[model samples]
Structures are given as structure tokens and as C-alpha cells.
Target chain A: MDWPTFIQSISNAVILGSIYATVAVGLALAFGVMQMANFAHGEFFMAGAYVVYVFYAIGGMPFPAAVLSAFPIVAALGIVTERFIFRPTRGNVLAGFMATAGVAFVLQVIVGQVWGVGLMRSVPTPYMGAAEILGAKVSWQRLLILPATVTMVGGLWFFLHKVRLGKGLRACAQDVEAASLQGININKMTALSMAISGGFAGIAGALMAPINAVTPYMGHSIIVTAFIVVIVGGMASIEGSILAAFILGFIHTFVTTIFDAVLATMVGVAFMAVILVVKPSGLLGRARV
Target chain B: MKYLAALAGLAGFILLPHFIGEYYVEIMILFMINLILASSFRLITTVGDWSLSHIVFMGVGAYTTALLAKYLGWPFWGTVLIGGMASAAVGLAVVFPLLRTKGFGFFIGSFALGEFIRLIWVKFHFPFGGPRGMIGIPSIELGDIDFYEATPYYYLVFIFTVLCQVVLYRIDLSRTGRVLKAIYADEDLSKCIGINVARYRAMAFSVSAFFAGIAGVLLAHRLGAIDPKNFDVNTMVYLVIWVVVGGVGTFWGPIIGVAIMMVIGEAARPLAEWRPLLFGGILIVFLTLLPGGLENLILRFKEMLEKLRSAGESQPAE
Candidate 1:
């Protein structure tokens, strides 16, 4: 590959990694806190994109504001899911995940019904130009993703380490009974995990709306990759998700560039399968009883 | 009395396609196919691992027969058995690496692995046709009877269903069934008792895939075409909903679940767009409110009736 093309692919990989991290961190958090894996997480991402589409594209609101709006909107959806589905199905991870699948179906249908599932919604690119960086012409919109992801992921890290509630989620993830014994409100922690999970996934989706085709079933492609990321990262490790996301992002981008998207996905899944077989606990994940 | 009930029910089912019209008969055939798929799924759950790939195995079976019959001029009966074996081989490959993890990891791993296989079809346009899928698959031709006719196809599916159900039922009733149940109940204890957990898990998966492949053979012939989209995660979710809504505890649960849901499915056919939402709602309700499923309700009602009968018997004796 030419140096410019190689540099461009690297930029693409970085942008993709940022998006994957943003989408996967919440999944790790939710899985960590309450053992709840939201199969509807990709739907939450799709909903975020739709939120941006409805507000910025259709309503002609400011693009930044529409993207900001996705966080709370999809976060609320996440909390509602936690309240109804996860809470009732708590302690049984499999059942809870399966039920979230129903949530996935409902969200897809509702979105399809409202938006008309026939064609992908085209959100006009609010940022239209490209930026030259390191001899590579990267689109300004794609360039923006790296900073946004760093900010969001950095903010999340600061909160988890410094904030009181964030520590409580960590506490709960470590030992539910012990955390409860320490006077932590398990419900609050779980709700918090899901809220953040939904919000981050939403932001990722909202940001990508213009770049990708927006459809109700768009979640199908993403959810598979997200699950692969989560599994490879370690089921409940936040940092592991971040690491795995970038690794997978590189794998996916380069492989896709080299061969094709289908083969890249096949390679990604195979990579995950290998990780699963080798280290069931994941790359950085500590084994839990 | 039990024998008479069984015989009469069998006769009624055999004569069902004669009375029903072509469309409903077709639906019944699809229903039987799903029954086999769902029951095979339940078999995997017995070992405490739920696979998201049973339908893909069925797809493998379908593709096998489709390709074999389309090009190789293989007959229906011969290809059906070969389909099962092919699926079983694929099942082992899927489950072997998966043996390292248990519970949720295994579940997601199986899904990833299954998606990998499905993607192979999507990625490849050769022998396995691409996304548009294969069409004009030759119909099943048995001696003296063209199975393309609805009645003949119905009877064909009926025999497959009955045969598969009987074999699966026997497996569930055998000592092997007891061992599988024990594995689910207490894996640690079962291992302590000399039960080979890993071997049984793999065995259960392959066996389940074998039947799933058989269903695939039935479906491929019935549809007279096959596509990669026919076996995907969306279809897997429906299978999960069926087994979950049916409850996986008993032999009758999936059958009962498929029957009730299929009825709702057919009746709500006019509202094509909203059907997924409806089924999705039902799944949430059953998973949340009736986790054990309709089968649990039936079992509880049966227990209540038994209690009342015993109470009446004691009162009369006194």
C-alpha cells in the first residue's frame, strides 16, 4: 500500500476504534454491574442515530445539539429497559439477555413503523470538508470522532475513579452482596450502568448517522461486532472493552481494506472465537468465581 | 384407554391435510418443521447450554439437500439422512472449541461462531448461492407420488415430524436423558458421579443439530428454494422465543409453545408489519411474567386438579 493510503487506513482504523470503544464501554459497564447484557444495545445506538435524524435532519436543529440530545433520549430508553426488563430478570443473565432481545425487536419495529423501514434515512452531512493530516486527507467529520470518543471515554474514566456512585458500581460489580452490605444501593448502580451504556451507544450512533445509512435494521451489523468486541474484551472489564475495541477496529479496517467487509467480519469473529477458547476470561479480565 | 387416545389422535393428524385446504396445509407443514427445530433446541438446553445455531444447522441440512438434489440428482430419502450427518459434523466443530466456556460465554460464543458460518454463505457466491439465495430447488420425488402436491408434502412432513419426535422423546426418556438432566441440575455433582459433562454436551449439541438438519431437509423441499437469509439471527430469536415461551422443562413444552404462537402468528397475518412487535411483546411477557412458560401453567393446573381429586377421595373415605 502507498504511504498516503496506509496513513488514510490508519486514520480510518482510529476513527472506527473510537466508535467501537464508545459503543462497547457501556456494554461492559452494564454487564459488570448487574450481569445484564443488553442485546438491545445496538438498537439503542440505532435510536440515537434516529434521534439525530429526527432533530437535526428533519427538524433542522443544530447538528451538535441533536447529537447531544441523543445521550439523554437513549439513556432514558436504557433506564426504562433496566426498570422493566433487566430488573425483573435479574440474577439470570441468560434470561435477561434473551428478554432484551425482545426489547431489540420492539425497538426495531417501532422505529421501522415510524420512519418507514423501506429505505435508509439519509442525514445530510453537517460537516462537508476534509482535513489534511499526516499526508492523508481525512474527512473533518471522521476526524471529529477521535476527540469526541477520547472526551466521552476520558470523562467516564474520571467519573468511575473519582465519583462516589462510579465507585459503587465497581463495588457492586466486584461483589453484589458485599456492596449491598456496604450500604450501596444495587438498584441505583444497575440503573446508572444501563443509563451510561445506552447514552454512550447513542452518541456513537448519532455521530455516525450521516456517514452511514440509517435504517431500523442497521443494528444487525453493529450488534454482532459489538458482541464480538465485548466477548474479546472480557465480559465485564471496561478497560478490556476499550483495548479490544481498538484491536478489533484495526483488524476490521485493515482486513476490510485488504479483502472485503464480509471476510473482515469473518476474521473478526474468528479472532473472538480464538480469544474465547484461549482466555475465556478475556485479555485483561480477571477471573471471577 | 391411553392406547386408544393415541391411536385416534394419530389418525386425526394423518387425515388433517385431506380436510384442510392447500394454504393451511402448507402452514401446518411449516409448523411441523419449527416443532422439530424447537424440540432440537430444547435438547441443547437440557445440557444447560442454549445454542443460537440450531437453525443454522438446519440451514446446513437444507443447503446440503438443495445442492445434492440440484446437481447430483440425489433422492429425497437419501439426502435427508446425509443432511443430518453433515449438520452433526458441523455441530461438533462448533461445540468443540466452545467446550472451554460455560453459561453466557458459551451462548455468545455459539452465536459468534454461528454468524461466522452464516457469513461464509453470504461471502461466497458459488455452490452456496449468495444473499439472493438459490431458487427452483427440485421437489422431493418419491416413487409413484409427486411430493410437490400439498397433500403429499403434508404427509411427507408429517412422517418426518412423527419420526423425529418419537426418537427425541425416547432419548428424553432414556438413561442418557437422566444424565443430561443431571448435568443441568448440578454440573459439579454430575461430574463427581462419573458423568462425562463435556462429552455429553457435545453429544447433545450434535444430536440436536442432526434433527435440526432433518427439519432443514423438510423445509428446503417444501419451499423449493433456499437462501442465506432463511437462517439468520432474526430466525434464531424466534426459535428462542418459541422455546422460552414454551418452557424447556418438559417434552411437550415446545410443541405447545409452537402451536399457540403459530396460531397467533397466522391469525395476525393481516397485520404484517406489526407481527414482530406482537411476537416481541409476547416474548417479553413470557420471559418476565411466565419464565417457565405456558407449560408451567399447565403443570401447575394439573397439580391443582390432582390436589382437589385427593381431597375429594379423603373426604369420601372419612
Candidate 2:
């Protein structure tokens, strides 16, 4: 490949990796704290994209405002889901899975009903120009995602490390009974985790709305990819999830560019199989009894 | 009395094709095939481990049967047996390494493994017919009688379903079944008591895979096509739902679950747009209200009836 084309591929890989990281980090958080895999997580991301699509495309609201609006809306939905669904299904893994799976299907059907499932929604790009950096062309819209993701992830890191409530959240994730004994409300921590996680997914969806086709079934592929990333990383590990997401993102993007999407998917799945065969617990996962 | 009930049920099943219409007969055959799938899924769950890739075993069987029959010109029946054995062999080879991991690790591991197999199906078109899927699968034939019609296929499916159920029923009541139950209750304790937990779990999975393969072969013949999309995650999810809704621990639970689900699916066909939403709602309601599943409800009701009978006997004068 030429230098410029190679640079473009790298840029695409980085952008895609950032989105994957954003989407998966929330799932890692929820799994870490609750020991439940939120199967409807990608739906939250889809909902966020729709939020932006409705506000900006249909209502003519500014893109930035629509993006900002999705965070709170999706976060509220997350809290409600935690309170109603996850709380009741506590300690019942199968129930939680079924409930989430049901939620995913419900959300998809609702979206399909609202927006006709025939054609994909087109979200207009807020920034339409491209930048030339050392003979490599990068679209402003694509570049914006990098900074937005960095800010969100950085803020999340700060919240988890530097804040008291964040420390309680971590403590609760580590040991619910002990954290409760120490006066940390397990319910509140769980709600908080879901809120943050859902908001992150929504924002990721909002950012990608311009670049990718927005459809109800979009979550299907996204969730599967997230599952693969989460497993390749240690489940419940935020750092591990981010690292794995980028690794997979690069692998998928680079392969797709060189070969075809079908072959790329095959290669990615093969990589996961080989990893499972070798490590089993995953690269960074600690053995849990 | 039990023997009489079994004989009557068998006779009814055998004579079903004569009374039902062709379309209805097809549905019943599909139900029989699904029963095998769901029962095998339950068998695997006996070891306290649930696999999302259970349907992939079906895919393995379907693809194996389709390819061998199409390319090698093998007899349909021979291919069916070969396909099932192939699935069993693959199950045995992977079960040891897979069962070594537990919890969500095993769950995700099997899922990836399944997807990997599917990718191979899509990538290697020469052998497995890629994304377009293989079509025009030859139908099974008996001596001087082609089983191409609905009646013959229905009878074939009914016989296999009964045979599979009989085998599974025997296994469920055997010494190995007892060991599997013990492992499910307390794996560490079962190991301490000299039960080979891993070996038994692998055995259960292999048996489950074997039946699943048989079901797959039947499904391929019924549809006359096999595609990569047939064994995707969505199909796997539905299979898991069938097992869960039917009651994982009960042998007959999945039978009831699959029958109900298939009926619901057919009934919901008119509601095309709203069907998925309705299906999701049903799942949620079942999860919240009937968490132990339909079988549990029946068991509880039976227990209540027994208690009422005893109470009436005790109150003699009243």
C-alpha cells in the first residue's frame, strides 16, 4: 500500500477502535459491578443514535445539541432498567439474560415500528470538510470522534479514580456485601454504573450516526463484536476491554481493507477461537471461583 | 398402565399422517425435529452448563449431510448417520477443553467457537456452499416408495423423534444420569465422591450433540436447503430460549416449550410487524412470572391436586 493510503487505513482503524472502546467499556463496567451481561446494551447505543437522528434530522435541532441530549435520556433509561429489571433478576443469571434478550428484541421492534425498516436513516454530517496532515486526508467528522471519545473516557477514568462515590462504585463491584457493610448502597452503585455505561454507549452511537448506517438491526452485529472483544479481554475489566477493543478493531478494519468483510469476520472469529484455546480465561482476566 | 399409554401414544403418532393435511403434517414433522433439538439441549444442561452453540451442532450435521450427499452422491440415510457421528466426534474433541473452563468463560468460548465454524462455512464455498447456501438436497427414499411426500417424511420424523426420546429417557434413568445429576447439584462434592465430573459432562454434551445432529439432518431434508444464516447467533438464541422456557432439568419440558413456541410462531405470522415485539413480551413475562418455567407450573399443580386428595381422605365425615 502507498504511504497516504496506509495512513488513511490507520486513521480509519483508530476511529473504529475508539467507537468499539466506547461501546464496550460500559458493558465491562456493568459486568464488573453486577456480574450480569447486559445484552440490551447495544440497543442503548442504537437508541442514542436514533435520538440524534430524530433531533437533528427530523426536528432540525443542531447536531451538537442532539448529541448532548441523548446522554441524559439514555442514562435515565439505564437507571430504570437497573431498578426494574436487573435488581429483580439479581443472582439469577439466566433470568437476567432472558430479560435483556427480551429487552433487545422489544427495542428493535419498537424502532422498526417507529421508523420504517425499509431504508437506512441518513444523518447529516455536522462538519463536512477534510484535513490534510502530511499528505494523508482525514475527514473532520471522523477526527471529531477521537477527541469526543478521549474526553468521555478521561472523564470516566477521573470519576472512577478521583471521586469518593466512584471509589464506592469500585468497592461495590469488588465485593457487594463488604461494600454494603461499609454503608455503600449497592443499589445506588449499580444504578450509577448503569447510568454511566448507558450514557457512554449512547454517546458512541451518536458520534457514529453520521458515519454508519442507522438501523434497528445495527445492534446485532455491534453486540456480537462487543461480546467477542469482552471475551478476548477479561470480562469485567475496563482496561482490558479497551485494549481488546482496539486490537480487534484494528484487526477487523485492516483485514476488511485488504480482503473482504466476510473474510475479515472469519479472521476475527478465528483469532478469538485461537485465544480461547490458548488462554481460556482471556488475556487479562484473573481466575475467578 | 404406563405401557398401555406409551403404546397408544405410539400408535397415534404413527397414524398422524393419515389424518392431518400436508401443511399440518409438515408442521408436525418440524415439531418432532425441534423436540429432538430441545431435548438434547436439556440433556446438555443436565451438567449445570448451558451452551449457546447447541444449534451449531445442528449446523454441523446439516452441512455435513448436505455436502456429502450433494458432492459424494452418498445415500441420504448414510449421510444422515455420518453427519450425526461427525457432530459427535467434534463434540468429543472439543468438550474436554471447553468444559475445563466454566461460567461465562465457557459461554463466550463456545459462542466464538460456533461463529468460527460458521465463518468457515461462509468462506469455503467449494465444500459447504458459502453464503448462498446449498439447495435441492435429495430426499430419503424407501424401497419402491419415495419419501418425498409429506406423509412419508412425517412418519420418518415421528419414528426418529420417538426413538430419540426413548434413548434420552433411558439415559435419564441410568447410572450415568445419576452421576450427571450429582455433578449438577455439587460438582466439587461429586468429584470428591469419585465421580468423574468432566468425563460425565463431556459424555452428556456429546450425546446432546449427537441428537442435535440428527435433528439437523431432518431439518435439512425438510427445508431442502442449508445456509450459514441458519446456524447464526439468532438461531442459537432461540434454541436456548426453547430449552429455558421448557424447563432445563425436565425431560419433557422442552417438548412442551417447542410445541407452544412453534404454535405461537405460526399464529403470529399474520402479525408480521408486531410478532417480534409480542415474542419479546412473552419471554419477559415468562421470565418474571414463570421463572421455573411451564414444567414447574405443571409439577406444582400436580402437587396441589395430590395434597387436596389427601386432605379430603383425612376429613372422612365432612
Compared with the true structure, what per-residue lDDT tens digits does model 1 show for residues A1-289? 8899899899899999999999999899999998998999999999999999999999999999999999999999999999999999998988899999999999999999998999889999999999998999989888889999999999999999999988998899899999999999999889989999999999999999999899998887888889889889898998999999999999999999889998999999999999999999988788630
Candidate of highest DockQ: 1
The interface RMSD for candidate 1 is 1.4
Q: DockQ of each candidate's interface versus the true one?
A: 0.72, 0.58
lDDT of 1 at A211: 92
Model 2's chain B yields a TM-score of 0.95
**lDDT by residue for model 1 over B234-254, one digit each (tens)?**
999999988888899999999
Q: Which candidate is the best by TM-score?
A: 1
Q: Write the per-residue lDDT of candidate 2 for residues B173-212, one digit (tens) a residue.
A: 8998878889989999999989988889889988888998
Q: What DockQ was computed for model 1?
A: 0.72
lDDT of 1 at A21: 93
Question: Local error of candidate 2 at A155, Å?
Answer: 1.0
* Runs with alpha carbons beyond 4 Å of true place in candidate 2: B316-318
RMSD per candidate (Å) reads 1.3, 1.8
lDDT digits (tens) for residues A120-232 of candidate 2? 99999889999887787889998998999899889989999999999998998888899999999899999999999899989988888998899988888888888778777
Off by over 4 Å in 1: B311-318
After aligning candidate 2 to the native by TM-score, how far in Å is the CA of A245 from where it should be? 1.3
